[model samples]
Target: MSVGLGLPIAAPEQLPTWARRADASPFSTLALLDRLVYANPEPLVTLATLVGTTERVRLQTEVLLAPLHRTALLAKQAATLDLLSGGRFTLGIGIGGRPDDYLAAGIEQRTRGRRLDDQMARMRRMWNGQPLGDEVGPVGPAPARPGGPEVLFGGFVPAVMNRVARWGDGFLGAALPPAHMDRLFRDVEAAWAKQGRAGRPRLVAQVNAALGPEETVAAARREAHAYYHPSPFADHVAEGILTTPRAVRDAVAAFRAIGADEVMLYCWAPDPEQVERMADAVF
Candidate 1:
């Protein structure tokens, strides 16, 4: 399986260094997280900043809350990023599970899934040279790839299966155990077949990791807890932290064995040293 590196969202200023290091290292992809009401930098904009700086690493939003943005605007932004990146971009999108984010975006969370469905349809049309019932054609430059950037869907709901089967190029299994990844991936595969999709969806899983001195590890855990606060997910994430070289190796092995196409090490520690530490642990 290909190994990828997630952005150290805890240290936004250091990302360019991390991005260059990840690209030059063994990491095949550079992933970023999105949150409007949080510390993580805005993913697409940050990623765009790296386009000329790195050549080979694929960029992903990890999971952009699709329902929070206007459909046409998102379609254009995504296409522009893909075009500039030489097609090294993936749009990992979802109906995010935070109510405060919804309130901040001034968008309701209750109908997010349905809105994403509509957004996907309209965005596809826009990418393929059709406007959203307007006078002009194509919203922006065509993506470097034929369609728009490959899209991956994220989230834990069964509704996600429908979205993947219908529109996603893959499933983004975020920070789940291999066992859970296996089951959800299988469910996605079954849905894909049921819907008569020509090929199976790509399976990309993530694991939160912090490999270094005790201080870095502790800080990573604290950051993780703060980000996933109040949700049972924080506890789940805590339980799954890979803090040692052996633990990181084992986690990657488990996901690879479970058929993940790629596994991104989601670093909680902001230290750029982690770029080499994680690479050393993995390969």
Candidate 2:
């Protein structure tokens, strides 16, 4: 199994150093989280800037909120990024829970699931060169990879499995214990087969991590806490933050044992050295 890393949410300015360091490392991919009501960078735009700076390592939005953006525009931006990045981009999406994002986007949170389902269809068609109308013609700049970048869905809900079956690309698991991830992945596999899909879905698991001095670890813990504030699950998320080399190694091994294709560690400590530190532990 391969391992990946997530850029820090608290520091956007460090991404250039962090992305370059990760690119030169053995990590298979680099990821970023999504937040509309928090102090975080927009994943797509942030990743787009790295396309020219890095040479290896795939780029991903660990889980970008899909319901808030215009489908056609998102399709264009993703295709452009994929093309520019030499087809090294993975689009991992989720129906976000933050009501503040919907409030900001002027979208209805209750309708997010339905909206994503419809948007997925339209975005796929747009990527495959389907025009909006006879008069509108096909969207400009065809995808670098045929049929566009691979799409992965993320969540703990049963309905998320349906999305995987319908799309048949992959599933991006949240930071949960191994048992929870195994159960969720098993359900996803069954749903995919029930839908008569040709092959199994790609399974990628994610976990939050921090490796540094005690002060740095505590600071990262506080960052994670603030990010998940008000949600009861915030405490649960905090508990899962892997703080040492053994913890990171054990997490990767657990996911690998369950047949995961990749383990994405969301490194919360913001430092360029953390990249080397994580790579040494994982690779």
Candidate 3:
């Protein structure tokens, strides 16, 4: 399985250097997290900048909240990124759990799931170059990939399976243990079979790691807790962070053994050196 790195939502000024480091590292992809009411750079914007800076690593949104934006616009943005990135992009989307983000985006919280479903359907049509009837031909600058960048769906419930079956190319499993990941993958595979999808959907998984001295690892735990503790799985997330090289090594092996196509190790600390630490541990 290929190993990838997730660029943390840190100071914007530091991102260029971080992106360069991740690109140069022995990693397969550079992923980003999305949030409207948080500290992260807008995933697409940050990714656009990296399109010119990084030559090899694939880019992903990690999980862009689709319900917050207009469907066609999001589709266009994704296609543009794919075009500019030489087809090295993946659109990972989900109906995120933060109601505050929805409120901030002027979206209705209760209808997000339905909204995401509709958005995915629309995006696929847009990517396929279908006409909108009122528009002047299909959306232009067709995706770098024929059908558009691969779409990966992420969420915490079985409802997500429906979207995966319809539009996604894979399942973007969250930061979870190998046992839980096993169950999640099985469910997604079952969903794909039930929907009669052509082949097995790709299986990608994520885990948080803070590889450095005690101080950096501690900060990683704090950041992980601050971001995840608002949910019901706070303790599980907090406890899952890999603090040592051995921890990172073990976690990667565990996820790969469970059949993950790629396992992304998200850095919780904002330090650029964290990339090297991770590379040292994994590469």
Candidate 4:
């Protein structure tokens, strides 16, 4: 199994340094978390900039809120990034849990699931060179990849598994324990078989880590609390933050043992050196 790194939210001036450090790391992919109501940079836009600095690592949004944007626009933006990144993009999408994000986008909260499904279908059509029935012709230039960028769906619901079976390249899991992930992988595999798809779907997992000194570990705990505060799972979130080399190794081993293709280590703090420390621990 391969290991990836998550790009933490940071000040504008600090982003370039973050990109350079991640570029230099032995990680396989660089992932991002999305939020319109939060302080982080837009995932696609941040990726657009990061591609200019890095040549090799792949990019993905750990869980970009798909229901929040116009489907066509999101499709175009994703295609553009995939092209610019030399086919190094995988779109990990979800109908976000935060009601505030739905409100901020002025979308009805209840329709999120259906909206995401429709969005995925429409985006796939756009990527497959299907015409929009307008003057622009097919959405071009085509993605750097042949059939467009890979799509991974996030969410632990059965409906989400259904979507994955139909339209996704894989499933994206966030901060889930090994047992939970084992069940999820089983369900996903079953869904694939039920759908008459040929093979098992790719699986990716994300875990939080703060791998430096005591001060950094404390701040990581605080950040974890703030990020998960609105959810019922908030308390359990801290239990997954791997702060030492052994913890990180064990977490990776456990996930990979359960059939994960990649495990992304998400840093809790904004400092680029935290990422460097993570490389030292993992690599």
Question: How does model 2 score by TM-score?
Answer: 0.97
RMSD of each: 1.2, 1.1, 1.5, 1.6
Candidate 4 worst ten-residue window by lDDT? 7-16
Instruction: Summarize candidate 3's per-residue lDDT along 1-283 as a digit string, tens digits.
Output: 8999888775666778888998888899989998899877899999999888889889999999889998888989999999999999999999888889998999999999989888877777788898766754687568999888999999769988777887889999987788999999989999999999998999999988888887777777777777775788776777778788998899999989989999999987788889888999998
Instruction: Pick the winner on lDDT between candidates 2 and 3.
Output: 2
User: Which window of 10 residues has the lowest lDDT sum in candidate 1?
Assistant: 129-138
The pairs that clash in candidate 4 are none
Candidate 2: where is the Cα deviation over 4 Å? none
Per-residue C-alpha lDDT of model 4 across residues 1-283, encoded as one tens digit per residue: 9999887775556766777887788889888889889877898888888889888889898889989999888999999999999999999999988889989999998999999888888888889889877776677668887767988988889998899999988998887888888999889889988999987899988888988778777777777777778787777786668888888888999999999999989887776788778777777
Report lDDT (CA) for all predictions.
0.89, 0.89, 0.87, 0.85
TM-score of each: 0.97, 0.97, 0.95, 0.95
Q: Write the per-residue lDDT of candidate 2 for residues 1-283, one digit (tens) a residue.
A: 8899988878899898888888898998989888888889999999999887899989998898989889889999999989999999999999988889999999999999999999998888889999887788788577788998989999999899999999739899987888999999999999999999997999999999988888778777888888888889778787678899999999999999998999998877786688888888877
lDDT of 2: 0.89
Measured by TM-score, the strongest candidate is 2
lDDT of 1 at 190: 90
**Model 3 alpha-carbon miss at residue 5, Å:** 0.7
> Candidate 3: minimum summed lDDT over ten consecutive residues — where?
132-141
Clashes of 1: 0
